[model samples]
Target: MSATAPTETQDLAPVRTESLAELLIATERPPRPSALSACLTFGWRAMLKIKHVPEQLFDVTAFPIMMVLMYTYLFGGALAGSPQEYIQYLLPGILVMSVVMITMYTGVSVNTDIEKGVFDRFRTLPIWRPSTMVGYLLGDALRYAIASVVILTVGLIMGFRPDGGLLGVVGGIAVLLVFSFAFSWIWTMFGLLLRTEKSVMGVSMMVIFPLTFLSDIFVKPETMPGWLQAFVNNNPITHVSSAVRALMDGTSPTTELMWTLGWVVLLVGVFGPVTMRLYNRK
Candidate 1:
């Protein structure tokens, strides 16, 4: 008679359930997917999206073509020595610009996800939280890398080969990529802050345009007024420009890249935590 009652109580004990806060507080770092494997997987997925929706490729592909034509043919001769010379100078700027500009996608896509409740679904997954942004950033960088390759290929065809040899060219590109990746945290904050994709675009434009133009992207900073020149000279983007130019020219500068790397370190230092905080609040 007691066996039936004993079966009910003795058979099982209630499992403890963790509160969300408890789970989060006790959470360990998610196991890392191999960086190389993750990169390839994420990169291919992103590129596949571009392949399926040809329109999405516009930012990387179409933008460069228009930028090259608009800057080179339209303003190159007036701005630089000649169209050809401008192409040589402008191509590097354009390459850097293209990658830097693509960082806007971070916020825009994040904003889109927030607006569409995509992130609501994302939170339910067991993966590393930062992996979402990490994947997006790396994938987008891959997109930018592909775009840079395309731009350089076209530039080579259009007589814009780098004076720098293979190693120098690779180093220059590497710096550009690192700079892009570091600056992405700023836009990631923007993306997490805003809820709409369009707002992301608007805010990004406001910040990016002034920074890009204020740098020596098209014109040398020396040509600016003394007051503006001082600011422009000190701008991190200018350091990047100087470094890229030096790299392309094969002139090993004593401290040019140090400055560029310093900017990257500074940006990561400031924006990285800010982005993480903003994301947490979201």
Candidate 2:
């Protein structure tokens, strides 16, 4: 058999190929979400978390009631002479403390996500990162609102009345929500700095406890020693508490309101940039 010379295989034309990056850019990507959409998306996400883990709402739910009851009764007698009388002063101040206590949850939540690498995934997403953050913080609006309503309702049952009427209560809540929202950015920075969620919780409590108790939240700053009064007078939480008290009482809040708002602006301007920077570096 004549060994037929092996016919050289004809060279086939090179197949067209798309780089992975190009393929992803062309086909796999969806439109990036708008700022409002991103915010609403994360806001719903946070709400859903509460739904799934209903215990997550304890801070807004049973805790506030318990705190209102405990503080109003415990300190009311010693501080204001009667629980009924105490509720007037106590309500607004307790509202401030309740929200501040709950504000740490934002840091804890963000820290949990960071530990789970959820934030890493977020970085790769097309959504506005800041919107996600703002939305997450905004979601806390409902929590703050819930705590406000519950506290006020219980206060009513317990004989707490506001001379400022319904409008004043609403305005007080508005002020608290704005200040708390701005304050959450401070925790956001802590979330970025701390390694563990628990650490964030502990550190937040450490800062929050002294700040809330030592301020005018439960008692008059004048009752404190002159030395302590100096710090209490300057404490930003004191300004917020005074503002809330004045707002609820429908008094002129110019001085305290100015200071409270100044704190809000300062916290947001300073910690906001620092949180973003640390997040990006990570």
For every candidate, C-alpha RMSD to the true structure in Å: 8.1, 6.3
Model 1 quality (TM-score): 0.81
lDDT of each: 0.77, 0.89
Q: Which model scores highest in lDDT? A: 2
Give all TM-scores, in the order shown: 0.81, 0.89
Among all windows of 10 consecutive residues in model 1, the one with the lowest summed lDDT is 1-10
lDDT of prediction 2: 0.89
Give the alpha carbon lDDT tens digit for every residue of 120-142 in model 1: 77667655556666666776777
| Quality of model 1 by C-alpha lDDT | 0.77
